[model samples]
Structures are given as structure tokens and as C-alpha cells.
Target: MVRYYGIFFQEDGQWSVRFPDAPSVNTCGETVDEAIEMAIDALSAMMVLGRKGREYGDPRGYEEIQAEAKDGELVFPVMPAEKAMEAYRPKKRINVMIPVDLLDRVGEFLKNRKGLDRSKFICNAVESHLQQNVEAH
Candidate 1:
């Protein structure tokens, strides 16, 4: 888990939140608690994008942020929970062709591995093969 610093403040009677590390992320709420919850949601969304290989700016130091903070502004840290990460991993279905013998072997192997499923096993195998070939080049 990674912790990110956020700036929370009230503006026009509404609480707003922004992450210095990721300026693109901003959220607002009717109350401080609500603002924090919204900030968590925003952070989770950003983490999902990062997991999908999106780039973000580096975080600002807490001291620097403290120096720059306006009156009534507060700094808080937020981290994406495991449930958030799991929720972000969306799965897709695809069709592939393979030999009947290979399919049978895979099925047998999966049956032996209690929690492993066919799609996950195949995906892992393909990813491993691709990585090996890429490294060989």
C-alpha cells in the first residue's frame, strides 16, 4: 500500500479535497467527513488508472505543502484499501484456440490447484511466455 498526501479545505461552505501528487484528482463534499470519503474515492480511482499504466506527477513534500497551505487548510494521508484494488481489477472475456490435448492437461492441472481457474492459469502462462521472449530479444 502507498500513502498519498491530500489537502482539504472549505470553500463557499463546501469541503474540497485535492492530492498534491496527482493534481488531476479533486473532489468536494458537504462536510469534512464527506470530503474525506470523497477523497478516498478519488484516490482509489487514481490508483486504478495507475494500475492500468497511467503516469502521474511526483508528490510534494509535506513541509513544502505546510509552508504553502492557506488558513484552515489541513493535510491528510490516504491509502487505497485492498477492497478498492480488487474492485478496480476489471476482467474481460476472450476466445482462443488450443489443442485438445493441451486443453485437457490444463483442465487436469487446474483441478489439482484448488483455487486456480482456467482463465487465470492461461493468462499467467501467456504473460510468462511473453515476458521470457521479450527478455530474450
Candidate 2:
């Protein structure tokens, strides 16, 4: 998952924040604090909308649920593009067992048409699952 922020300054001396991947949101403040308050309100409203509309292709719109906020800003889960790339370098080895049904389902994933080792497939799956629930502050 990628999280990006955009700040827009209004003519009325207010500032607005936005999530590029999520256009439904725009937070604004009168002063920086007030605008931050308003932006939080906007972020909340946008989440409600995303949930209702099933944004991000998740019926629960769980991605819209942010982590506990910090400094009045709503944050979503993500890896910086460069850091994410680094994750693939010098990976370690581990093993675990899943239920037969679960393993079968993972095996059925289309992206692994040719083949997908459990580790790589699980990594991708975990990332996708995290996008649905994990978030930052």
C-alpha cells in the first residue's frame, strides 16, 4: 500500500490536506489548528463515504478506517516506495503451516498462475490484508 499526502492552500488563508489515492478527502483549517480540525472532520466524512461506497474495492471499506490519529491528522498504512523496495532485498527464511483449505485457496490465486512459493505469495497476501486494516498515525 502507498500513502501519499497533498496540501492545498486556499485564498482565505486556510490550508487543506488531501490523500492523492483517496480523492474523497480534503481537510481544511482556518488557522493551522482550526483547519486541521476541519480537515479531520473532512477525513471522517470521507471514510464514512468510502465505507458506504466500498472504495478501494473492499466491501467493508476497511481501508478507510485509519490508525489512532496523532496530531489531529488521519493516517493510512503504507510503505515509502523506497523502503518497500528495500523489503525485497536480503529477505530471511521462515516457515509456518496453514489449514489445508487456506493453503488451497492461496494456491488458487490468479497472480500465481505459473507458481508461487508460499513465502512470496504470503508476503503479497499479507501486504494486501494489511492494506485493509493496518494504518498509521
Candidate 3:
């Protein structure tokens, strides 16, 4: 339900969008409509990534953003879909106890798998086990 303020500018027939609140977030498209769509995507992605670094800026009021708009710039308010936000929900950390031998086996298995880590391996294993159990039932 959070809202962000953005400015859209058209140049040479292409449209570009930028968030005043978040200087690091911006996108462009062939048309104004397309630019708005891309802006939503970029905003949603930044929202997810920002949670990790905790550095995303806060949105300004409508009047404030509109007043700052320059010539040929259109001020727009964007609200990211709740579903999109939930889809990129942050991971939760939890502690687990495992036997020493199994821990060693996990480490050895990960050593052979490039770009795979203990967290991903464990998550996949647990999901697979749950799927099998559900299917059996």
C-alpha cells in the first residue's frame, strides 16, 4: 500500500521515469504507458533490494513533487502491487541443529556444486521432502 512519487519525461519520442525519493531507481520505455509499467517494475525491485541494504529514500508529498517538476516533466504517483511485493518477500533466518557427520556431508556436496550454498541446498531438500510427503498423502 506504499506510494512513491516519480517524474516522467519524454525525449525524442521515448519516455523515461525517475523516482525523486529514490535517486538510484529509474527506467525508460518506448511510450509513456510503457514507461509507467517499467517504473512499477523498477520500484518493486528496488523495494525488495532496499530491504536488504535499508537505504531506500522516503516518498515526498504530491504537491512537493509536482512543484519540483521541470518543463516537459510529468509528475506521477506509483503504488507497487501488494502481490508483487509479497512475491519478493525477504528470507527469514533460523537456527537448526544437525549431526556432525551430516554437516560434513553437506559441506562436501556443496564443494562440488558451483554457485550453490548451504541455505539453498537445505531449502531445496526440505521442499522436495515436503512435496513427496504431500504426494503420498
Task: Give, for candidate 1, the lowest lDDT window spanning 10 residues.
Answer: 49-58
Query: Tens-digit lDDT track for model 3 on 76-116?
Result: 88888665665566799998999999999999999989867
RMSD of 1: 6.3
> What does candidate 1's lDDT look like per residue over 1-137, in tens digits?
67777888999999998776777889999998988888888788777756345466566678876666688899887777666665566778888899999999999888879767888798789899999999999
User: lDDT (CA) for every model shown?
Assistant: 0.80, 0.52, 0.84
Which residue pairs collide in model 3, if any?
Answer: none
Least accurate 10 contiguous residues by lDDT in model 3: 49-58
TM-scores for all predictions: 0.59, 0.31, 0.59
Q: Of the candidates numbered 1 and 2, which has the greater lDDT value?
A: 1
The predicted structure with the larger lDDT, 2 or 3, is 3
Q: Mark the regions of model 1 whose C-alpha exceeds 4 Å error after superposition.
A: 51-54, 93-137
* Residue 42 local lDDT, model 2: 55
The alpha-carbon deviation from the true structure for residue 81 of candidate 3, after best TM-score superposition, in angstroms, is: 1.8
Model 2 segments more than 4 A misplaced: 1-10, 51-54, 57-137
Model 2, range 1-137, lDDT digits (tens) per residue?
43344344453666555554555655666666665555545544444334345455322222444332235444433223443344434566777778999888776774547645767778888898888776641
